[model samples]
Target: MSRDIDYGNLMHSAMRGLIKTVLQDVADHGLPGAHHFFITFDTSHPDAELADWLADRYPGEMTVVMQHWFDNLVVGEDGFSVTLNFGDAPEPLYIPYDAIKTFVDPSVEFGLRFESAEDEDEEEPSADPMPPAINTDHAQEDADTAQKSDAQVVSLDSFRK
Candidate 1:
């Protein structure tokens, strides 16, 4: 039995599960009200599938907005596939859960950021273990005021050991 508790990996799993649930809901009953998603994923992931042009365009990562128009959203255990309009062309993409870098719903001031295992491995032992604060609010207001106001800033480091 391993005594080590992989809290970081655990958190990542939970966050991915949350995203899957939300996306499944959207797929079943359309995006409700003002809810929208800004999903940024690593395009280089082996399981991620996209057009050759898209891969050439976003060699590293890509962010897709799920608002006004989207089609064929199919959420699966490992990942999800969707068709999004790029300019006038509809492009289909498959993004694995592990490839996701960030998920944000600016409309409701909610967001999640995931650090890849490679990133974690590259961190120096002396570096701060705490992840940076995530500002859920995307309002175009003064940063100082926004920080001081009721804007929600979530930090999971508090839950870590």
Candidate 2:
């Protein structure tokens, strides 16, 4: 019997692991280091729930600043929940493991992207049998990570000299 090595499953688990780490850090130590996330996700993802009000507002993807604007963020086993203030009202959103599309930080210029399993499975299979959606070779794909690493190395050179 042969089993499938679903790249979607692999990527999903890997992304979840990264998110779990960040959530755990915030839960235990209260946002340490220069890491805070600007998470933008598919609001309509099956596991995601937004009041009709907010859903209509953000039909595609919406970015939330986790640094100073969020309150009562809770991390759960399958998903995480956070409350954000829109105007005079506060809206609560729960994003499941599969809903997250991208987590970005403009400050540090680092990003973690999560692909939904459904989206992955929708891809047309090439002759290779296994298709990888996350590619780091492309310039646009790794711009943030490369840019930050370059900036850090440049700054570190001064201290070494």
Candidate 3:
């Protein structure tokens, strides 16, 4: 039987939710201990909003470190807003979560990499779904045996190759 669920998309959405949750926690209680975020997002995405000069500076992507310097951090359901220092000037940046490619807290060695929704090659869902090659039996075993961690390394190299 063909699988109806899109596990990859489901996992991606859940991970993004995790990002929102963490940001919300920080907004409420401030950064806990040494935890800081390295949020990388597509500056050119339509939903992303930044200063004109900033967009010119980072035409493709930019990673902002939210350690000791960011202010007015707000996480919304679909996006976030933050004020960060830009050469002694404070610049407000609004980034849609869909535009965010990665979120990392290197202090805790935690990170998540997301596939850019703007990838030109992505095709719309077909009327008929394709069947997965892997068997479902091992999925439960894998889930049961896997351990949880604050960090995970996802290599884009695998996808590239």
Candidate 4:
């Protein structure tokens, strides 16, 4: 067995750790200033827990905004649970970190997008592992402007050996 450092997996783990830390801080002291998040996760993930109605509405993936009105945020080692208001009804959701697809904080123009393992497998094999794409776009932009241009995405290839 050849020993090799899996930088791609390492980077993914580090990014997830960063998300966990950020959420933990928010759960402790609440969101600060204009810092908010738009998190998109796979509702079909085995560990993802949500209301049946929500599952029916969003069969594949769902995006949740953590800005003005979210409560009972509890971040754990594996996942986080939060209660969000939807049409005057509060719904509690538990999302595992592994289920997360994209996490964006447009307030600071920062975002991270995770590709599924299957996506990586579909790509042609190469000596170097492909880095996940990081989008730095403003979600507050008008729909037309947003659609006109693609978000600038930065890759971690340059940082790799």
For this target, which candidate reaches the highest lDDT against the unseen true structure? 1
For all candidates in order, the CA lDDT equals 0.74, 0.59, 0.68, 0.72
Q: Point out the higher-scoring one by TM-score: 1 or 3.
A: 1
Residue 56 displacement in candidate 2 (angstroms)? 0.9
Which regions of candidate 4 fall more than 4 Å away from where they truly are? 121-161
Stretches of candidate 2 off by over 4 Å are 116-161
Comparing candidate 1 with candidate 2, which one achieves the higher lDDT? 1
Predicted candidate 4 versus true structure: per-residue lDDT over 20-109, tens digit per residue: 999999999999987767677889999999999989988888877776678999999999999877666788999999898777666666
lDDT of 2 by residue, 1-161 (tens): 99876655566577677787788678667766655565667778888976788788778766555654566778888888877666546778898866776665545655665544444466573352111222222333354334333322111112221
Task: For each candidate, give its TM-score against the true structure.
Answer: 0.77, 0.65, 0.72, 0.77
Q: Considering summed lDDT, which 10 consecutive residues are worst modelled in model 3? A: 128-137
Clash count list over all predictions: 0, 0, 0, 0
Better of 1 and 4 by lDDT: 1
